[model samples]
Structures are given as C-alpha cells and as structure tokens.
Target chain A: MMRLRLVTALLASAAAFVAVSAHADNLVTKDRVGPADAPKSFTLRLTNDGPTSTDPVWAEGYQKLFSEFIQRHPGWRIDLERMSDNIGQEQARMLEQAKSGNGPDCAAVDSFVLALFKGANVLKPLDEYFTKEEVADLFPFIREGITGPDGKIYAWWWNTDLRVLYRNKEIVPDAPKDWAELKAAALASKEKGGEGVLFNGGRWEGTTFDWLANFWAQGGKLVDDKGKPIFAEGENREKFLKAVNYFKDLVDSGAAPKRVATIVNYDEFNAAAAAGTAALFIGGNWQYGQLKNTLEPEEFAKWTFSEIPGPTADQRSTGTGGWTFGAFSNDPAKVAMCAAVVKEIYAGPGNALQQQLPTAAALYGKYDVFKTEANETFAKALVNGQARPGVPIYPEISNQIQIMMGDVLSGTKTPEAALDAANTAVQAAFARL
Target chain B: MPTTTAAAMGAAQRRVAGPSLARRIEANPFTWLVPVAVMLGVFYLYPILDVFRLGLTNASLVGSDERYTIVTLQAMFENPALLDILKTTAVFTIASVVGQQAFGLAIALLVMRGERRKLKGMVALRTLVLVAWVIPGIANGLIWQMLFSEAPFGAINSVLRMMHVSPVAWLSDPNIAMLSAVISNVWRGTAFSMIVFYAALKAIDPTLYEAASVDGAGHLQKLRFITLPQLRAAILVNSILVTIQTLNTFDAIISLTGGGPGRATEVLSLFTFNTVFRNYDLAGGSVLSVLMLVISLVLALFYASFMPRREVSE
Candidate 1:
C-alpha cells in the first residue's frame, strides 16, 4: 500500500508538471498574429519607435505597421525595443551592440551613420533583396546614401525629412524668403509680445545640419570627392563663416533670443509652440505630426511650414535626414524578411499613416496623403534638400561644428576664431583616423 | 547552561580533532576576509586592471581592430581640447566642492542649533534637506533643467518676467551655464555633507559650547574655535570624498548642459564618456578613465591619512 501510494504521488506530480509546461507554451503563443498553424516561425528583434515611445503618434504608427506586417507574414512575431530618443546616443549604442554581436536583428539607424556600421562590417548587405527597379525608385540622394563605399546596399533608406521654417499663419502670414526678411519678421513678432524665431542652437547634430542648408545654398561642400572635410577651407570657409555670422546676427539683434542656444530637440520647439510663445521656429517637416498630436485641432491647423530661409531670396536649400534599418542577421531568409518588414512600414501604407515623406518617389502617387498642401511644400523643399555625407568622419566634423556654433552664437568667440578652432580639431581627428 | 554547553563542546572538539582544518582556518582572522577579498578582486581590481590594459591597446567600441599601442594615449594628450577640458574640470570641481561644503556646514549648524534648543520641526527640516539627496542625479538634473529653462515659460524665467525684468540666459551663456551646473550639483550633494557634519557635531561634548558661552565667546568664535577644529578631520575627509565624487559627475551634467554652450562644462568625466561612446574610441576613453582613477587614488591616499590609525599584530 505504501509503494502504491508513493507511485501515485509521483504520477500526479509528473502530470501537473506536464500540464504547467503546456500552459506556459500556450501563454507564449497566445495573441500571436497570423495563422497559428503555419509551418515556419520567425521572430524578429527590432529596435525602433514602438508602443512605449514618448511620442504617441510616432509610437502608434510604428506599432500599427508592425502588427500589420506580422499579420501578413504567418507565424511571425516582433520583439520591438524602443530606440533612444537622442540620435547621438542611439547611434553610439547601435554601433557598440553591433560590435558585440548581441544587437537586435534589425535596428533603426540614422541614414548618415550607416557608413560607420558598414565600416564595422556587422550589417548584412541587402543588394540581393532589393531589385534594381526598386532601388531606382528611391530618392537620388538616398540611393547614393544607402549604398556603402563598396557599392552594396546595407540599409533601407525608407523615408526622409526636410527642415523648414514653421510659422503661425496668424502671426507671420508671409514666409521670410531671406535672412534679412526672417530677422525683420522675427523682430516684428517680438514687438507684438510674442517670442521670436527659435531653432536648434544647442550642441548637437541638428545645430550643424539645419544650418548647413545656408552653406549648401551657396554651393559649399563639407567634404571633397575623397571624403575629406573642407568646410573650413578657402571658399567653403567663407560660406561657412557667412552662414554662422547670420546666426550670430539673429541672436545679437534679439530676433532670436540668446536662449535659442538652449534648444536641442524638436520637442522643445513644439513645447514652445504649445505654449503659444513662439511665433516662428525652424523644425523638421515631421514635426507636423508631433504638433498635431500635441496641440488641439484648431491650433495645429493654424501652423504651416515653408522652405528654410537662405542667405538671399533666390537661393534655397534645406537639410534632409531620415531613419534607416540595417539588417544584422546572417541568414538570407531573415534578411529578406527584414526587407519585407521595412517595405510594409516605409514603402507602403505605413508611410501614409506616419506622414513622413517616403523615399520612394512613387509613394506620393500611390498615397493621396502625400499630396496634401503641407506635404507638397515639403516635397518642393526636398528638391533642394541636401543630406549629410555618409562617412565615419562626418560625426566628428558635426561635433566640432556644434561646438563652433555654440561659441559663435554665445559671443564667446567670433565666427572666424570658432571656425578655425573647429577646423583644427576636425583636421587632427581626421589625421588620427 | 547553553553557553556552558557550547564552550564545553568547543573545547572537546578542539582536543579531539587537534585543531581540524576548519577549526584552524577559522582561528586566523584573515580567513574571515577571504570572501571580501575575493569580491574586491573580482568586482574592483579586475575591471580597473582591464581598463589599464585597454588603455595600452588601440581598441574601439565600434570596430574589431584592437591592437596593443601607445598611439591612443598620445592622441588623447595631443588633442587640443584636452587642456580646456581639464581646466573646466578643475573649475567645476573647486566650485562644486566649495559650494557643497559651505552650504552643508551651514545647514548642519542650523539643524544642530535647532535640536539643542528643542526647536520644533527639526526632524521635518532634516527630512526636507535629505529629499534632494534622495532624488536620483538624472532626475535632479531634469528638475533643475525645467526650473532654469531659458524659455519664458520656464519656472525661473517666468518669475523674472512677472517682475518686468529681462530674462537671463541661465543655461546658454558659457560662464552662467557652468555656474548653473555647479548650483544644481551643490543642491543635490549638500545633504550628504550635512549628515556627515551633523554626526560629527553630535560627537562634540556639549560642555565645550557651554564653557565657551560662559567665557563670552560669540557664536562665530565658538564655531571657529570649537566646532571647526573638532570637524577638521571630518572636513578633510569629506572634502576628499566630495572632490572625487564631483570629478565623477557625468549623468547630471550630461542632462543639464551637455557639457556645452561650447565645452564650457565638459569636465574630465564627460570628456571620457564622449570619447568612448560618442567618438567610439574605447582605448582613448580608457586612457582618460585611467587618468581619473589616478586622481581618485591620490585623493583616496589623502583620505586614508585622516583615518584613525589602528595597530596590527602578526
């Protein structure tokens, strides 16, 4: 009787353990998208904006597209990780993780830093996944930017953004076409008891990239054909100096407050707008989505964007930037699946929902949302948009430029002195590399 | 009876086993420290040694081309901004240490006076001061950033605007930005020094103050002659510790000014961080890390000099 009782207890324990294991499996598999009986199961670890993102609109759009993609691909699941809101930190973290071989299978990388990853040789090239016809559909700059030095596509440059002067239609009815008009309008807004124009004057890439448009409008190049930084060299130096001086004039004349030097992120610009303190600001085209999400409908409607004012009325340019996804999976099947995921998010309906201008020019024709007046303005702006060079040295150059801006704008150093110092630093870094 | 039983059992065990291995091992006090030594070696020594090792190599966090070399160290020292960064670090450390010590000592004296006089709400005051210290450094930075926001809507600027005064660039101007960072750091760190000084004050005999009062020594005189001299060791020790702490301040400054308005607040810690993470130069960052470790170690020796000496026997 004792033996029979012991045997029964052991049998009961084994049955309970099996039941718990089956329940655990059910818990893991529950709420999965697509067909449950699909033969293949693929899980993608992706780092991008997701449900936990601080920006609700961006998060919602990303989450929706990811779910839709998983539903389309049977037995697929995505483990989404929220990327860092700070661009520099995110890029650095991605590069560090890539070296460790423990990073996510796919990561949302800034387009300009794709070269750094390519140099690391951790990203799987996507040339075979994307066809020639598909590649040709991308913007010309993006087509060039996404391809590594070895003439292989390692990332999908899905969407791009343009920097522009966002103004309140009620306060500033007419767009400023030049630096002089911009300053005049900003001062006029200040006189009317509203804060003047604001831009990213803080120590970050935005300070360099947004202002680079002014230099580019004058046909200035940051680097030469050999990817050598020449922004502070002879002719380019003159243009760079002129551009920085204009920024100084704005701060010195109080058209834009000296405090504009504290603005680092677009969310700050949006916050100023939400407070109804800012009459005009320089921000990205996608800020329209952020503004819409942050402001009441009528308030958001009162705002619109225009080309970033150049040195003169006829000269026009704006800095273009965008996010890209670099696949790190070695398996070709996973790489192809990651490309499909990128397509579902960027090259298709996701672009329309996200409201970022898609890199594929045909998307405008496919999605009516791209034809809106605001997006059309952005599209026109893109004609003169210039993306930062996809070189490893560009980050260092951008850092030096950020410091130079802070110095010149804050009156700590003159534009000439700041540029010379910045040039020296960049040159030394370049030489070391 | 229980104690007697344990003692007898111990004696019997020792006699029977003739100081068995376990018994002999426990007999030496150093055996008790073996675990702690192992922990220190694994956690502290190994990582620090690795930092020095990496400092001698050309390693990158982003690339896999590490090699043993001195070029990274040379590059770090040769970099033009190194001098500026070091100078900024010195200014930041001095300002923060001075501010924390002064404010901490003042608050501690006030609280001690309150307690001696049987004043109400002394506990509340202590807790309130401690709240700042309890807040995480990053949160403190963010809180201060909101308060010092350059925008008109910012808490400080809003108050200034209400008085019809022109707004101040609290975080944009280079000098003012550094001052702002120092102020924020002092606010977050003062509580620590206050607690230390308060405890040291407790150890002072009350009769000293009573005798000083009878002799007609003023409050300032009592503080100078009695309190300060009594706290001399503590002040020195606290100074060294706070200096090291201030040197390692990265998160708060990073969140506050980002070492900016043009590298004005880029202390050694921020420089090391930016080099490793932002510049992707692990070896270069390691060199900076080693420099900081040397500084801390020097300060640690100074701290040790103030500690009470104890005798050891073989």
Candidate 2:
C-alpha cells in the first residue's frame, strides 16, 4: 500500500511538472532555446545573442523576446541554434550546411557573405512575406546590399556596426585625427604605464576587416565591377602600400606591442580596455556596450570614441559590418514564421538592448539608446562607413590581406614584398575562380 | 533389415551430418577474417581511396562546378608556401619528439630509482606526470597560452618582471611561436613516452645490474652498456609513435598560436586544414592530405626497418 502511494505521488508530481512546462510559451536556456516539441518548428542560428554568462542584459532580453515571439505565434516553435561567434567560421559552416541541405530554416549570416549564399541559390526572397511598410523602412545601403541581381530582397539586413578608435579620455584628452598623432599619443600612454594601442593584427578576418578602413580611407579599390583583382594595380597600389606601411610603422616605432598578432578577436581588445590596460584600441561600436557592462560606471564614463584615424586628417573612412537574417527553407509557411521571428528580434526592442545600430531608418531615435553621445558618434561614423566588397572573391582577397598584415607587422616580410605576395595570391585565386 | 557393417554405418552417419559449422569455419581461416576485412575496407580503405579520387578533381565546397584536373597538385608543388610548411613540420616534429623522449626517459629513470629506494613521493610524481597526458589537448593549449602570454598577469612574464627581465613575446614572435608550441606539445606528450619507458624499465632484468655492479661498473657505465642496449626497442617504438603523433598535431598549436605570427608554426596538418576549411578548396586539401599520408608512411617504413625482428626475451 505504501509503494502504491509513493508511485501515485511521483506520477502526480511529474504531471504537475509537465503542466507547468507546457504552460510556458517557450524555452530559453543555455542548452536549448525554443518552443519545445511543437507541431511547427523553425530553427534560427544566432551567436552570442542567447543566454551568455558574460552579459546578463543580452541574455534576458533575448529570452523575453523569444518567449513573446512564441506566445504570439501560438502553435509555431522557433528553435534558436547557437552558432560560432567567429564570422568567417560561421559563414563557412553555413555555406557547407546549405549545400548539404542540412541548414537551419533561418540564420544570422554575416552581411558580406549573403551574396555567396544568394549565388548558390540557397536563400529565399523576403519580399512577399514582409509588410510593404517594413520593407520600405530599411536603410538604403541595407536594401541595396540584400537585393539580389534579380531585384528581390533575399535577406533582412538587421543591424550594423562601425570600427572606431576607442580612447580613455583620462589617458588622452584629445582624439587623434591622423596616424602620426595617434602614434604619438599611443607612445605617450605607454610611457605613462599604460599598454598603448591595440587592434586586430592576428591571422583572421578581424585583422583584415579592422584595418581595411585605412585602405578604404585612401580611396583604394579592391576590385572592379567585374570582380577582377585590381587593388595591386595602378594608383591603387601606392594607396594600399601606404595603408600596409602604417601598421608596420606602429610596431616598428614601438607604439603598439608585437603581441597584437595574437589578438584575433575584438573581445581581447574589450578585455584590455575593461582591465584599464589599453589606453586606446580600434574596435567595433558594439564594444561600447561591452565596456559599459564590464567596467564600473565611473570608469565607463572615461571611455569615448572617434572615427578611425586616417593617413591624413582629410582622409577618413570606416568599415561597416552587420548581420542579416536569411531564409533557407523552401516551404512558404516556414519562411513566413522565420521572417516574423527576425522582425521581432531585429526591429523590435531586442535590437535596442543588443546595442548595435538598427538598420531600419524608422527605428532610430525611437529609443534613448540611439540618442546617447557615444552612439551619436557611431552614427556619424556609419555615414562615412564602407561595406566590404560582396563579390565571391572578396573572401580570398581578405584572407591574403590577413596573412599580409601578420607578415608585415611581425617584420617577417617587407611592406613591398608582402603586398606583392598578397596580390599574387589573390590574383591566382581569382584566376582559378 | 540386413545387418550393416561398421564401415557402412560410419559412412551413413558422415553423409547425414556433413561438416559441422564450427569445423567448416575452422577449416578456412579466411572466413574468420571476413568481418575485420570488411571493417578495414569500409572504414579505412574506402576513405583513403575517396581522398585519392577527390585529389584528382577540382572540387570546391561552395561552387557547383567540379571536374577532373591535376592543377591543384601542380599548384601545391609549385607554391613556395608548401616548402615553408614542410620545413615547419619537420622542425616541430623533430623538436617535440626529441624533447618528449629525452624528458620522458629521464623522468622514467628517476621514478624507477625512487621506487627502488622506497621513496615516499614516487607515486605522486608519476601521477602528476600522467595528469598532463590525461588532460585534453585544448585545455593544455589554453593553460600554456596563459602561461606564455606577454600580458602583465602572464605567469612566465610576471616571473620575468619580478626578476627584472623584460617580457618576451612568446607567441607573437615569428620564431618563438613555434618554440612555444613545441614546448607545450612536449609537456603534453612527455607523459606518454614516460609511461612507455616505465614499463620497459620494469621489464629490464635486475640481475644484469647486479652483475654490472659486481664488475665494478658505475651507474653511468651500466646506463651506457646494459640499460641503453635493453631500451633500444622501446626507444624505436616510442620514436615511431611519437613521430606520427607530433606530425599530425593540430589542436594544441591552434589554441596556443593559431599557427600564426605569419604561419611560423603551421604544420602539414594545419596547412591542409587552412586549405580545406579556410580556403574551401576540397581538391587542394585532399592533395595535401595525400602528401601527408605518404610522408607518414615513408617515415613509418624507415623506422620499422631499424626495429628488431624479435624481442629480447624471445
């Protein structure tokens, strides 16, 4: 009789647990994120936007948004798949998955690689599913960026970020406008027991992406409209060489340490900033949120940023990178569901909390977050921002430039030799393609 | 019924039963090997054959266009970067193997001495060394990365600062990054060689040492003559195993230096990875893989030729 009673109690408890779980609209945990075991499910790939221990605000905001999304959709489920934070690896993995027909229903693809997917015919057009007003609200560049050759929006370019020089006002009061002033200020900081300037100098996309602003600031064109390698040819060669030499000079002058070669991730720069080790760093606008989260309020107030310093005061440019939600499913129902999820997370309050610049022109100034002085500065930076070449050969070109940066920074190769070698490699790869 | 003769009865019984299943299997050894043969063919031979077939094509991960071509192989051979990768692989493998073996033999001899002397911490020392080997390669790489960092809090750099020495760019220098990778690999792999050597040491006859002592031989003399000669087989085996292991090492180096400071530490395996995953050149990566396999096979054959045909005891 006692055994029977215990069994009944266990069954009642399990039933209660199931009832509570079923009542909750969605699941958002470190391991799983979605409405579990629903009749209709769509998988979404995201990175660092889910439950992360490093940033509680991002995690809570994402959870609430996903929960609300599930509540509104009733029976439909949104499965959030965590992807690699490294954009290059994520792009490669996504391309491979799409080719194999094993990809998630929707993914937050790096904006630059969307063209590659579109070329491969794995993406679905978002024109029919999205409301006309929502489509009209997108920023001009984002609209152009996501539009395929056939004149259809293939992805929702949600949020964008720009590279800039983040400086501690306490260390250096004035922002440097050019490379020479920046170097002097960096060296001065080092003399005052600070760790000097930091940037992405490692062998990865970050290294090339972070430094491409300098190249672009000089009006260097990477390729022509036909996607031919031309950055090494004509007047562009001198501009490219100057940009490469600027980084080499930084290390050669002892303004930046050689250890930058190991800093492949922007988080490394943020950590250095939060630790009060770096006086200045070249990083993305999103790092401001990270710094605000990681540092004390008083210390966070000391941080400010300016446009990326150029070869001269007159020449200024920044590289803009963003994430886009792309649909890979052929089923219209699944595509619509995925589009709804993207709209909620991107244009909704979730993006505001995430701290990246929203792509919709209508969404800006709606929140005080966009009105902040730092964000205002980022907004200006975005005005002069240049997106990477969306052609297929851009990845190969970026890779060669990445290796070139390492070689030049470490003094393994001269600026001339590195440029020649990278040009040769890019040209060879382009020829093969 | 007619009375049957014994021979007739036996013949009838044999005809009725035929050969037993076990007897049939025992009669043909090849039947027993079919499962293993199939497994080898399916798992090993098929993949290797597929790689070779892919190596002869111009396949890519992204593009749909693929065709038969030797252009990838020709380009790989003509590229100067291939020579650098080979050189780096040679240096990293040699350094790691030599370091692991040297440290391993020394630790093994010391541990044996401790045991013979009834030392209290012999077991603890062995456990500590074995702990390194048991740790995951990625963890080992991360731990070493922190230790070798040039940051103010870096363990090694902190000690250097305390000693009034400047911090060294352990992972940033083009030359030192490879050394750092080798050091981390040796630390991770030394314990493997130590265990192998320890077992070999246990199998060595104590009577020979006793005889050597009676002959007025010192420790050095005994080590030079008896111990060294007895360890010949173990050394060769360890060399072959460690060589193959170090040749294919990727995880630790990747975590430590990411084969950087301008590809200073990129070995054949890493180069192949970069070719396949980073460059998305499946055919080129396959060709590189085939080259690596050939290199490994050649080295294995070269080592096997020097191995003794029979064990000392046999």
- Scored by TM-score, the top model is 2
When just chain B is superposed on the true chain B, each candidate scores a TM-score of 0.91, 0.92
Q: Residues B1-314, candidate 1, lDDT per residue (tens digit)?
A: 99999999999988987877787887987988999999999999999999999999988866687789888899889889999998999899989999999999999999999998999999999999999999988888889889999887899988999999988788998999999999999999999999999999999999999999999999899999999988987898899889999999988988888778889888999999888777777888999999998988887797778776556862
Clashing pairs in 2: none
Candidate with best lDDT: 2
Candidate 1, residue B312: lDDT:
88
Give me the runs in candidate 1 sitting further than 4 Å from their true place: A1-48, A55-64, A296-298, B1-16, B20-22, B28-32, B303-314
TM-score of every model versus the real structure? 0.89, 0.91
Candidate of highest DockQ: 1
Write the residue-wise lDDT of candidate 2 on A115-146 in tens digits: 78887788999998777788778766777789
What lDDT does candidate 2 reach at residue A368?
A: 83
Listing candidates in order, what is each one's chain A TM-score?
A: 0.87, 0.89
Candidate 2 iRMSD in angstroms: 1.7
RMSD of each: 7.4, 5.1
Query: What fraction of the reference structure's interface contacts does model 2 contain?
Result: 0.51
**Alpha-carbon shift of residue A284 in model 1 (angstroms):** 0.9
